[model samples]
Target: MHKNDTLNPELKHAASTESGFTLVELVVALLVISVLAAGAYSRLANTDTQARLASLQSFKATVLSVAAMAKGMCISDPQCDIDQYQTTSSTTIEGKPILFTGRYPVGLAPHGAGGLDQLMMPGKFTIQPALSDTNRATYFLAGAHDERHCKLEYSITSAQSNPSVLSVTVDSSGC
Candidate 1:
């Protein structure tokens, strides 16, 4: 008691007050931070799938627009034979020869003439001929896991009225 009384009041107060957190408090804080980080990471992970889906939608729109324009050009040109489905026809647009079958642009090259590839602008996707079907052009998202599942398939429809079909398939696991 005498030694304690000899010490200054300010020094005694400073010694009694703790400067840092206890082990239990530190552990709880770490746990909360970890939980928040986990939640944030999960949310961020979903954004990639969303981004790929959006890209696919945009690409599909571009493909539809290009197909329509090519069809219009085919209809306007006297050389394009829209009535003949058995025989392939072609017309030049912007200096590129676009191959067509019954008023619709073919999905792939036909007899060395350009199809969908010539119409579409270069994008961030990888374009390849679909393995399952020769008539389809499959566009895969760059860095995607399952190329077949996560892709946009552009194919020429048999019916002249429909002309073409754009199919989008996105597998979340692939993204």
Candidate 2:
């Protein structure tokens, strides 16, 4: 037998075939994986902002509900006046006296006793100081990109004569 013929048949066949990924194939696979990863990352990044906006919407609903309940209580009580916009009033809820301005609940106070925070407890949010006066309150998420830009503002009309205005505005552009 010759020297070349002495080699194993399987080894010679494998060497001739050379079955493996080429450089182009490997690069394409890597590129696909990177694209998929980038898409997933972008979706994940937006999820946080969506979550914040949903939370703010839920909180706004709660604020509206609380104000409606307070106003209902005020209307039912003969002593309480719902039309008085300039004067602060009180209504008993859950055996606790909640103060109100016209038909809307007031914001947080310095001593942390009487305000909208009392009615709706701050669960995952941080209650900031009352803006301008006790009528306006701002809430921020616990961990946000910019608290000032991404926040929920609750304001009640006190001195206005038109009607009681309980505004709950959410600014989630910076969230």
Minimum summed lDDT over a 10-residue window in model 1 is located at: 163-172
Candidate 2 C-alpha lDDT tens digits along 1-175: 8987989999889889998899999999999999999999999998988888888789888887887887788778766674666677777777767677775667764444466777787587777764534688888876677877778888886556566678888887777
lDDT of each: 0.73, 0.76
How do the predictions measure up, each by TM-score? Answer: 0.75, 0.80
Query: Where is model 2 more than 4 Å wrong at Cα?
Result: 1-18, 82-84, 109-113, 130-132, 158-160
Taking the candidates one at a time, how many backbone clashes does each contain? 0, 0
Model 1 residue runs over 4 Å out of place are 1-8, 16-18, 84-87, 130-135, 159-173
lDDT of 2 at 11: 89
Candidate 2: residue 143 lDDT (0-100): 68
